[model samples]
Structures are given as structure tokens and as C-alpha cells.
Target: MPKDQKFQKINFDLINNLIIIPIEINGEELTFVLDSGVSKPILFNLSDRDSLQINNVSEVTIRGLGDGEPMKALSSKGNVFKLGKVKNYNQDLYVVLDKEINFSTSLGIPVHGILGYDLFRDFKVEINYAARNIKLHNPDLYKHDPHSKSQTLRLSIERRKAYVEGTVLMENDEDIPVKLLVDTGSSDALWLFREPEKGLEIPEKNYEDYLGRGLSGDIFGKRTKVSGIKIGDFELKDAKAAFPYRESFGFIKNLGDRNGSVGGEILKRFNIIFDYARGQVTFKKNGNFRAPFQYNMAGIELQHNGLRYIAESIAGFNGVVKSEEGSFGNVQILLENKTRLSLVPEIIVSGIRAGSPAAEAGLQAGDVILAVNGKRIHRYKLQEVLKMLNEKEGKRVRVLIERYNKDLLFSFVLKKVF
Candidate 1:
């Protein structure tokens, strides 16, 4: 280890609006989401094929976003954690044993865990969403990147989570000042707690949608768009927003004075730096700053079911060159591509909004998606498949699914909601 090194930059994956990083726990490696909203390291999604050693486990009950009952989890203490050359000993983390609480299917990758707070507290973290990498700088040796347009906002760290100040421009031409949680783990843009008397009102033109999943269960809410938001010198217009029902995200209402949260969808548009040690965060515009928000308009949610064999053909000579005897000089050579079947991910329709186009077209929840618009879904990632469906409002989608050992075909047009 060098004492003069300024920072260590680690490349990360920006998948489905979430940051995925490679981290090691007790010498075994796993992928984790760097969630600013989550305070501690929580592990789950371990299958029978995964073998890892976790030390010191005790059962406990914890609750989060969704409306489900408190989840039972095991708290593991005194473990080693590593990322790049950074190391911490005797770290404490919680592990969920529920197999159904997995994000690998929805994300098209294994999301074994989520970690935050500790990392931000230990280093001056710079997240360049446009660059798809993170820089963990030594607190003592930290230096801010030169940016004339950047603004540093005060970070209020309470209960191991960070919050920022912003103003939401409502549909009625009201600028409502708010204290929003900076939640990188959430994929949506903004989530405003509905308090009509306080000038925070849900627009009349909104639709009920699946917001995301939390510790408790799946969170459903009303989705809409606010006129804009003012954060420092920047203003984002027509930002996609969601109002999580008080019933689903009840815990958020209890967080002292927090009006809502600025999620990854908005955060990704800026290059940000989180200096938890100094109680501040910096924001600067990136390449995605002006990009319009894209939403899933097909009204169907897709998830990984399992794996199926897909045959691929490869060209190769079929004859043995040196050892083959043509039996009197008549040579028969067959040169054709050989067919090879290999395992690939299979996608399934997990949910369909009632009254939406997919439901009208007869797409069931358990239907395994085989192809979409004449393209095999096995060759694409979940996000890629989503892009295919969400490309345009009037895009027609043809889907082939296997249900009850029967192949079924369905067609639907992407209709705009709200």
C-alpha cells in the first residue's frame, strides 16, 4: 500500500439504472448494488450452486419499503470485506434466506447483495454515471474535480442515509421546496409523498404502476411526471415521477421531514460526488443530462425464469485430414456447420397491468417468453428485451410464449398511459 496514492477507481456496471460492483466477502466474490439509501450490507439471492462461507449468523426481523410483514434475516458479524485494494475487517452485514427475494431474474444478472453508508463514510466517492466507474478517494487526500458548473449541496446524514434539498415544480405552477432522500438504488426519478395540504399533490393524469421491490415486498404506486425540479443551478423538466402509496411505503412517511427521494433515474443524468465525511455532495451535468426519460410502455414486466438449451451452428470440416482413408482415391468431404445446443437464460412475463395492452392481448403472468417480434429472447438481456418493447408508444410487439406445455402467440400495441 502506498501512502501518497490519491484515489482508486473501480469500473462498475450501470444495469437497469442500478450500479453493480464486484465485492469480496471472506475471499468469495459477489456482485452488489451500491445503494445510497441502504445503510448496511445485506446479502441474499444465494442458490444451491453458490458456495460461500459467511461467519457469525443470528436471526433478526427487519422491515423496509413494501407492505409485507417484517422479513426474517440473519446478521453476520466479524467478517472481512474487500473491493479493489481496500479492505475492512470485522464488518457486520445481514443476510436474507428467502429464495423468492431475488433480483437476478429482473436484472438479468445475479444481485447477491447491497452495500452503502460504510463505503461513503470511509471514502470520498465520485460516481461518474456517464463513465460507468467509481472513484474512491482517500479522505485526507481528496481533491474535487474541476467543474465551473458544479454545485455542492449539503448532505444531511441521518440514520445512515443521505438527503438533499430540492424544489419540485408541480402541475399547478407551484414550486414546492422539499427535502429529498438521495436514493441511488431506486430506478425511478422522483417520489413525492402525497400531502395535498402542503402543496404536494398527485396529478389527475396518473396511472397505477409497479414502482419497485423493497425489503418487505413489491411496491406499487401511481406514476406521473412533474413539471420540473430545481436542484442548485440545474433544472430538470418533465421528469418521470412516482408517488408510492402510503400503504406500500409507509416507513418513508416516518422518516423525519423527508418529503421524498431523488432516485437513480434523475441522478444518472449528473456526475456526482458523495463526500459523506464532509457532509456534502457535488453534482455536475454529464452526457445523459439532457436525455429524455424512457419508460416501459408495453405494460408487461419480464423476469428470468431459468435456462433452456439453444442450438447454434458453427462451420467446421467434418473429415479427418490425416487419418482418413478414401478407400481407392474417391474422397467424400462434407463441410457443414455443426449444430451445438447450449444453455441460455429464459424470460417469463412476471406481471401485466390490468386494463393495459398486454392484458388485453392475453399475455399471462407465468407465460415463458420465447421470442419477441421474430427475435429470440434467449439471446438478449432483460433490459435489452425491455428496450425492444418500450422503444415507442405505437410500436407493435409480437410475443411467443410457452404456457402449460403449449406454445401461444400474442400481439399488442404499446399504448401511452397518462
Candidate 2:
């Protein structure tokens, strides 16, 4: 029999992907994900409380990816957490109470807690999202790359009305200094602002005032192209950004020390060394990291109504022509072309926004949209449907839906906007 391959010893010196660290809450050891996106002290969910013997409870208001009111959380202290060689024998760690902390998935675990900048400020940290490793060092003694120069500058997050000192490159400068979040969970492109005054910018002159979600609540943002950004010795121009005009201040204040985050989008494009033991991150701008893409465009900004992702896309071969249809929501699917997909859910016209297109067509909330142009709505996405509608502007099309579980079909004309 062939010998079994021994699992590599857990490397505390470098944490890539997810690592299980021993944390003692009230003398009981538990595990949590080390996340930068968490924005605060250690947080735990309601499910993990019983096992950890959390005996006390406090009403703490916490925010997340939606517009729901602040969530109440439980808190405690006398907790001991060990990361690699460093140890926090006793500290006050906050625990967030929620049955299922949903929004984004972790490396597989149920995202128990996050260790943010509080602890990181004590050490120099480096994260290589590409290599999947996080290294810590002492900031005072860490070595700087010969090709890189460091300067502490101010960054203003307009929504938060605050600024922080961040280190960036002094070369290939753009008028807008790249504002970043030192987030570890974001595996996407950098978010840029369009209206430098509003501190946001959107391409195609479109703005989604109610579209945004991360560790914060739903945000208003604009979509636009980023020619690129540079920091230290690295530069990523021609990148795309989802410039959100709003966000929660908790995180902004916490990471106000770093200009913005140096996320995977730009990190993957370079070789980085973070000596958190010392408090510095260095990047060598040379690597093959492509930004996340959506149909040649770099991203697909979207909104959700609880059950689905709602958005439009350009249609047909020339990118001309458009239609509107309900793409299945949130659920994943595999397209006929072997591409992976997130199918939109079945949507009947919910409440139509006042004075919107549907309302003018005598379409009201609760109207079911069944089919378009006599063809059964099948295998089409939200963008494709919108494209079809745009292409057939001013033309009448038949729509079918089930209201009160009764199948109803009607005709509506697409109107031209702009």
C-alpha cells in the first residue's frame, strides 16, 4: 500500500486560507477566523455561546450587510487567544449574537469571530491573498523594500467624515490617492469613487443609490472604471471600482490608520511580505493577478429584495437591444455553456416604485411577470431580460405571471429613458 501523505504541520508563522487558533473564553478554548473585514474586537455568534460557557449577556448594537436595525450582541472578558507565537492571555472580546451570521461565506467555518486592527496594530502584518498566507512581525524593526518608499498621509472617508494616516508609493501618482481598506475577506477588485467631491464616481452615468452590502449595511454607490492606482512600488491602473458613497463608520474608524485596504485585487498582482511582528506590509509589484470579471466588464453591481439579485445587463451580440425579466435570485446554477451561475428567483412585480416604468404601464405591485413576446421566460437572466426590453423600446410585449397563484398575462409597452 502506498504511504499516506502526512498533512503539513499548521504553520503559525504564515496563515493562508483559514487557520484554527486556540482562544479561551472564560478558560475554554475555541476557534475563530482572523479577519480584517470584521472591523472590531473579537465577536462570537449565539450558537457558539453555549459551548463556550458565556454566562453574561449585554445588549450591544451591531451592524451588518442589510438595512435591518442594529442587532443585539452578548459580551464578556477574561478571554485568552493565541495566534502563532503571540498570546493574549486575558482581554475583553465582544461576542455578536445571531443564530446564523449570513452575508458572506468564510473558508468553510461558520465565521465564529474576527480579530481586527486592534490586535494588529501591536504587530507588523503581511497577508498574501494569492499565496494564502498571513505573516506577522514587529513594525518598528521591519525592513523596507529597496524599491519602495513609505510616507504617512491622510485619507478622508466622506461618509464617515474621518481620515487616517496611510502609507503609499510616491511614483506614477494619480490625482486621487488610492483610498483603501486593509480587508482580508474581500476577494474582489478595489472600490473607487467617481465624484471626487461626493467621493464616488459611476460609469455610464448610472448610480444605484440603494446598492451596497459587506460587513456594513446596504449602501448607495456609483459604478465606474478605474484607470488604476499606485502605492509604494506597486500600481494597478485600468482596474474597475464599485464606488460606494456610503458605508458604516465603525470599520472606517477602526482602519483609519491605513489609507484604504490593500486587498487581493492589487495584492495578487505583487509579491508581498508583511512582518506583522514589526507592523509593516511590503509589496513587490510583479505577479499575474487578474481582477474579478463580469462579462468582460470587471464587476456586476447588484441589489437584492431578500429573495434575489436585481440588475440589468447589455444584450445581444452588439451589446445593443435589451429586455427585462426576473433572473432567479441568489441560488447557484450551471449555464448550458458550462459556465457557473447564480440563478435569479421567480419575481412577480413586488411594489412598484412610485412613478417608475412599470407603474406607467398600469403594472402594479404583486403582478406576476410570466413571459415576454409569447415565448415562455426560460433560461434567461435579469440582464438579458433588460437588454431585450431596451432593444424593443416603445414596442408592446406580452407578460405573464401568477398572482394569488392565478396565472395572468398582460401587455405592457417599454418606454425610452434618456
Candidate 3:
């Protein structure tokens, strides 16, 4: 018997060139982003706040393109939230307790929440990005053909990491064997890279500047064409991909064992399954998976024309930094270790993502970051300052600021939530 096999299977389709799934929240109907990259599920609506029945409170932080702010998170044990026929609740869920969830206001959809790994772990998920559809399968119904194994390739999908372990069948091979995270939240094209190559390869022809923004900031990528990407007896031919060749992605180099991400633009074609508990993912090709719904790719867009800042407010200005500036401000401070440092006095409000040590300490947009633990932030490059911040986690730090020209000091306890 399959897990929850009695629930009716939900069918999805495209509407206005978008993917949407009907959902219900607290007896009200809504739609949510079928996000594969989200570490967990989320509900974003102020109207449903009181009814959410939050059981615990934990300080949560996130880094995105726009001005990042600190907000309260409402969590509860919901083991039975339903999606079409799939029910998941009390399984460790997180919801942003704000006035309104981002989807309802921006996309004009009553997004009950985002569906992520918690539900995907039980089923096979196939995303044919080229066709813009998704397929799900019960493991009991999926059988691996013994004959296909002789020529099929296998990608090891364990713990959200998808790596090309070995080749199953190599007919129209273009993509090299590389470890990748199959990111379902990515609506754009795919990203390709190698561990050793700091640069990426783009198509010599029909090359266009691929522009977009992720959690970090503005990103420029190189567009290219791969004959196809084959995984587990499947292949997607004439696929469009991008290669980001910039300094902002240094952390990607530190992925240590993983390489790149397998985005939605490539995964929408097969009945897919993501078994995180077993560290495996399976996919079966099925073209009949269609829906009459539309959904937006979850992302924040930012443009970086080289701007700088000091603290949360723009230097000598009365508001937050809106666009890129040539320079912001310069400040001199004395470190606790007796080392004097000079730095731009702008507080990094937005874009300092969750799981970062700074976010772990309840740092907010208006809260000025004067020093890293005890090291005064002065006379430092952006990169150097980040390096210093990384050194201090779960440690007490004093932050001094000049908001409205008044000196204010705040003591923060830094932690890591990522």
C-alpha cells in the first residue's frame, strides 16, 4: 500500500503562461507557490494570522533583493494541510506573521502557503521546464525497468542534492557530470557550472545577456544551449541554460561537494519523486500532466548600478537606499581590541539573508551594525567586513549607530539559522 493513497490525486495545468494549484487554508481557498527550493512551507496572510494557532515563536530572518527587514515568525504543528489530495500538517511548518503574504498582494492569488520539501519527500517529482508542467507519482506505482538500466543514467538525489552519479544512457550528451541541487522554485532557465572552472561556458551563437536577481542581488549570466540533459533514462534536448561568471558567487565555490542547481525550467516534464529520507529522487516521463492554472516564479528582483550606503539610512539623506549609488559615507570607530577601523557607515539592511550570523542575532533593517562582535567596522572593504562578521556567531556584539544624528547603541546576540 502507498502512503495516503486514498487521497484524490490533484491535477495542475497552465493559465496565462503560469502554473497554479488550488489550495485551502483555514477553510478558505487559495493558491500557493509549488516551491521545491524552500527549506520549508510558509503561509503569508494577515487575515489568517489569529487563526493560524502558532504554537512556538522563533526569530527568523531572510536575505533577498529589496530592503530586508526583520519580522516575527508564527509556527505550529500542522500535520494535515491538504494540497489537492496530498495532506501535510503538524509536520513542522513556518509562516510569516505579517499583514499579508507576498503572493496574495503581488500575484493577486490567495496563496495559502508554499509547498516545499516536507510534502515532496514522499513522492517522485518530474518537472519539464521546457513544457512548463509537473508530474507526481506514488512510489508503489513506479517501477524501474530492468532493461532500461543497461543504458540509463542515474542522478543521486539525496538530501536535496542531485548529482550525476553515473550514466544510464548517453546518446545526446552535452552536460558534463556535475553535482546539482534540483531547485523547483527557480522559474527561469537553468544554471550550469563546473567545480574547477571559475568561468562558465555559453553558446557561441544566439548568446544574450541573461539578467536576473536572486537572494543575493543583481546577477548577470551567460546564455547557452545544450543539446540535452539526460537523467535516469530521460533526456531534455535543445535546453536553454545560463552560466553566471561573477565574484558574487564565491560561496557557490564552497558548496564543497555540490556543483549547481537543477531549476524548474528543466524539471517540469516528468512524474517526479523526491525522497529526502532515503536520499533518492525518481522521475518518469509523462506528457499528459497538464493544468489550467498559472503561478509566478518566486523571486525578488534587484538592480545593482554600483551604489553604496552607510547604516540603514542613506548618508546625508532621510530614507533607505533605493538605488545603486557611487558612494555613501565614511565612519571611523575604535575596535574593542584597540584596533581602529574605518568603513562606510551604512547599515546593511536588506539582502543579509537568513542563516547568516547577523540575521541569527535579531538584527533588523533600522538596527545599525557598528562592529562585528568586538571588531570595529572601519576602513574595510565589503568583502573584508563580511569575513569579519562570519567569524562571530552566537556571540554578544555591540552595535553603535547614528540614526538621525543621535548616537544609539544596541547589544545583539548573534546566531546562525541557515
Candidate 4:
């Protein structure tokens, strides 16, 4: 075998708070989400599985965050995986057979599967979040620059998962030491498990809400802002955090001893270096390090759809539009001969939080959002649209939506209910 490359530069896409990398699986190019929380490489959401060659396949079962039952998957081996200039032979992977979960629409791009610990095990990966690029260095030849201001923290590995010790200041001025899993896959800033025995409880002000969508179903939890979090020599104040209901997180509760997790919302503030081989990680603050952390106050979830439109007559106007929610709608709209239609990407409302500013404005799932604050929806990505909604509390949001082939206008002010 030839010697591996000493260094490899890999460009990546930062979508929906996840690092997406392009990789080759069995000589076929595919997009995979880089997640440090996953122990092994998993292949799922393939458009055509028969085209990919595989060997030694067996059936398996896997469980994730939701209320649904465990999903049926496949365990396969002897597949070549390539990341940038580096390659690994005869790797193992888990393939999910289910096709119900489509991350592309939610992320505004194609995502084939997830790659995790397996990639970090052999290389010292430096992730420059600001530049949207990744550098994989051969561990044997990798060296940390002596003049850099990056802080390094030892990582405790268990079952291929990385964890670090941190201190969280409670509202009562009590500082509690906790073990936090470094999970790049999760978008929340922090997730503190409620442990009454450890004096851990839900913060004074919090809202019962849906944390995120998991493989099984919606993961419900409480969202709050914490006093502060200290990791090594760095400290962040008033960080947004989540506390999942213990009963709702049955699977995560069984995953060893852990107080909480450090997710992408917090990690994005720093340029990170993961040296899994050396059992340590480094952090360097970026431009967004001091940005205030905010949650969605609009109470609506938005998804992306390819550019497509139709014409419908305005003669028969009804308050309701017969179209499927969460799926693409093909409604015919009638336009005059001289009328010009603007072709832009479709942004659909996927979910609505009860009593939210959006919900109060009569926004419902399946509403095709056309604009926000007079700005066209096509001008922004799904995440950017969300940021506009969460920019500030009490900010007025003017929106336009298409329903039943009629353009409707609405406005609301973002407010903090919790």
C-alpha cells in the first residue's frame, strides 16, 4: 500500500448548523454530514442503493431520539471510503432501510448519510468554520503551532464518543461541574440533563417546546438561557440551552453517564480541531464568538423546495387551499397574458408552534412563504430565514404567503413567551 498523504484540504458546506462533506463510498461520490457524536459511519437516504456495490451485509436495528419504535437497518462491511486525499479500506457501515426521513428539504441541500468517529480516528482534523473548510492532517506528521492562542482540552472517549469536563453556573450563583459530550450534530447550544440528585433542575424561566425532529419523531424539551459555561480557559455567558424531558429521552438516558452536551450552536463560535487519536481537542474563537444566542420566536418551521410555480384563476376564492402539508403542492394559478411571474425557490412552512407569533398571525403548516420584512424568501437559505425570525424579541415581522392560489399578507411581532 502507498503511504497516506501528509495533509489534505477539504472544502465543506455549513448547512442548518451541520458540517457537510463530500466523500466517496465504494467509488461513488456522496454527501455526508460530519458528526462527532456518531461512533460509526452510517449510510442511508440513498436514491438508488442497488447502484452501490457492497459485501457482507446483515440486518440490524437502530434507535434514535423520537417516540417511534426502533428502525430496521443493515450492517455492511468491506467498503472503501474516501475523504479528500485520504482513503480507508474495508470499512464498516450501518445502512438505514427506511426512506421516510429526508434531510435535504430541511437543510436546503442533498445529504446522503452521516460520517463520524471513523474519520477522526486516523487524522487530526482542523475545522475552520469561518472559512467553511476542513484540513485533515496525518496524525504522525501533525504539529500544533507554538504561537497559536488555541486552548486544548483533554477528551475522554467512551464507545467512540468524546466528552470534556466543564463548569456551568446556575441562576443561584452555584457553579456545578459537569461532563459534556462534544456533539457537533446537535444544533442546540447546550443540553443539560435534569438530575435532581446532582442539584440540576430546569432553569427558572423556560418554555415547553419541540427541541428538534429525530429519526423516530419530534423530540420535545424545555428551552432556556443559562447563566454561563466554562470550558478550560474560555467562558461564555447567557448561553441558550435546552433541557429535554427525562421521560421523552429514553434512548439517550441509557447512554452512559453524562450531564449534558456541547452542540453546534455553541461550537460554531470557535474554530475547532479534533485530535481523536491524541484524545484532545482545541478551540479558537471566531467572529461569531460573542454573538448573542437566540431561539426561534416566530414559532414556525420552514423547508426548502426547488423552484416551481403554477397559475390559477382568482374568480373562485376560498379561504382554504387543498394541498398536502410537508409535501410539494402543485396548484394551478391563472394569470393574465401580460402578467409576469417571478421564479424563485419555494419556502414552505413545515410546522407551527402553538401561540407563537406566526401561529397568532394565522400561519399554518404548508403555507408557501413568499417574503419576510418585504425581502423575498428566495434571497435567503432556510437557516438565514430562521435567523431573521429569531433576530430580536418584539421585532415586527411582515410576511406574505400563497394559499389557494391567492397571495395573502400578514404581519406579527416576535415576542418571548417563555
Estimate, for each residue in 1-418, the C-alpha lDDT of model 4 and write its tens digit: 1265668989998876789899998889989888888888877777634578767999988877676778888899989988766888889998876886667678876678888888788788899988989998877777887336789889888888899899988888788899999988887789999887886788989877878766666778888877999888889998788898765567764756799899888888889888887788898989878987767889888887566653334555554444432223234333454332334458899888877889988988998988788887665767788777777887998889898888899889988755
lDDT scores of the candidates, listed in order: 0.85, 0.45, 0.48, 0.80
- List, in order, the clash count of every candidate structure: 0, 60, 54, 7
Candidate 3 TM-score, true structure as reference: 0.51
lDDT, model 3: 0.48
Tens digits of lDDT, candidate 2, 1-418 = 0123211112321122233344444565555555555545556543424566544456566666443456667666655555544556556566765544532222222335666555555554554444555555555445554553433233333332222223232223334554565454444445543344533334453434333344344544544445565564345555544555534334333533233444444445655544433334555544354543221111112222224332333233342223434322245443344344444444345343334345555656655455667654445543344344444456766666566767776665655332
**Number of the top-ranking candidate, with lDDT as the measure:** 1
Question: Higher TM-score: candidate 1 or 3?
Answer: 1
Which ranges in model 3 have alpha carbons more than 4 Å from their true place?
1-7, 15-19, 45-53, 63-80, 84-86, 97-112, 124-175, 194-199, 202-220, 245-253, 273-280, 286-418
Give model 1 RMSD, 1 decimal.
6.6
Where model 1 places Cα greater than 4 Å from the true spot, the runs are 48-50, 251-253, 311-339
Alpha-carbon RMSD, candidate 2: 12.2
RMSD in angstroms, all models?
A: 6.6, 12.2, 17.7, 5.9
Residue runs of model 2 more than 4 Å from their true location after superposition? 1-33, 37-39, 46-50, 55-58, 64-66, 103-109, 138-174, 193-200, 205-212, 247-262, 271-280, 290-418
